[model samples]
Target: MDEQRKKGLEKMNEVYGWEMPNIEGDPYFDLTVDHLFGSIWTRPGLSMRDKRLLTLAAVTAQGRQDLGEVQVNAALFNEEFTEEELKEVAIFLTQYVGFPLGSGLNGTVSKVVAKRRKAAEKGAGEDKRANVNAAVKMNTGTSLDDE
Candidate 1:
């Protein structure tokens, strides 16, 4: 892999809490990994937590629960946001984004929390923080539209 692509893949994995493989040849994946993640995400102005909040809000406002779920799961897995904080985000967003969209986000938050809890329970013997990738994959699934 080229330097940018390698960097993108690592950033993508860190952001999403997944172990995404490098899939060459597809223009969409290539651009996503090389440009969006490599060039944009790695920029120094914003912290990862800040970027995640913006992304979560944007996706929630657009009624993209699938994407929102991914963000929520990542945030939780990475410990960027506590469960209570995520619940608060849903409530805070509901006011500006309207009840329907906010309600959807609230629901997404609940689902992600429950899934994480369940996974933690299932792997009671394992260290949840150490198995971030497995928990994230089980909860969010793999997707190309991560951003």
Candidate 2:
């Protein structure tokens, strides 16, 4: 196994407490890692930060909050994103995507941010409702036409 695969597997077991067995004996091992994660995902053109953003978007588009949360947490751990970044992603999702997906993603992102911020003893922040409303207005180009 190359160093990155070994390290990822080890970290998965240690931090996440899950053992990922080798699907194949040896030949496929390095190939699998290289093609899937290393070659494709680690392409030099896109910065790690941009990859994280696209990943979050793909997960959000798929409406897979569980997988999305896993990636989001990883991004945070890797310093690929911050709590504010998560919020902005969710806001963008709300604007172009549908409200349901947006809300669901926002909820998951909020929980992660809150937990992480609390762990870091950072000050709490406002809820996403305000941001959502603003996004709706922006997307619709409306002033509410208050009567």
Tens digits of per-residue lDDT for model 2, 1-147: 667776545543332223444333444544544454545565569776787788778878889887676666666656677877887888888887788888778898887766667856755343333333332233244323321
Instruction: Please give the range of 10 consecutive residues that has the lowest summed lDDT in model 1.
Output: 130-139
Name the runs in model 2 displaced over 4 angstroms.
2-32, 117-147
Name the candidate that leads on TM-score: 1
lDDT of every predicted structure (CA atoms): 0.81, 0.61
Error of 1 at 78 (Å): 0.6
TM-scores of the models, in the order given:
0.84, 0.60
Cα displacement (Å) at residue 144, model 1 = 11
Best by lDDT: 1
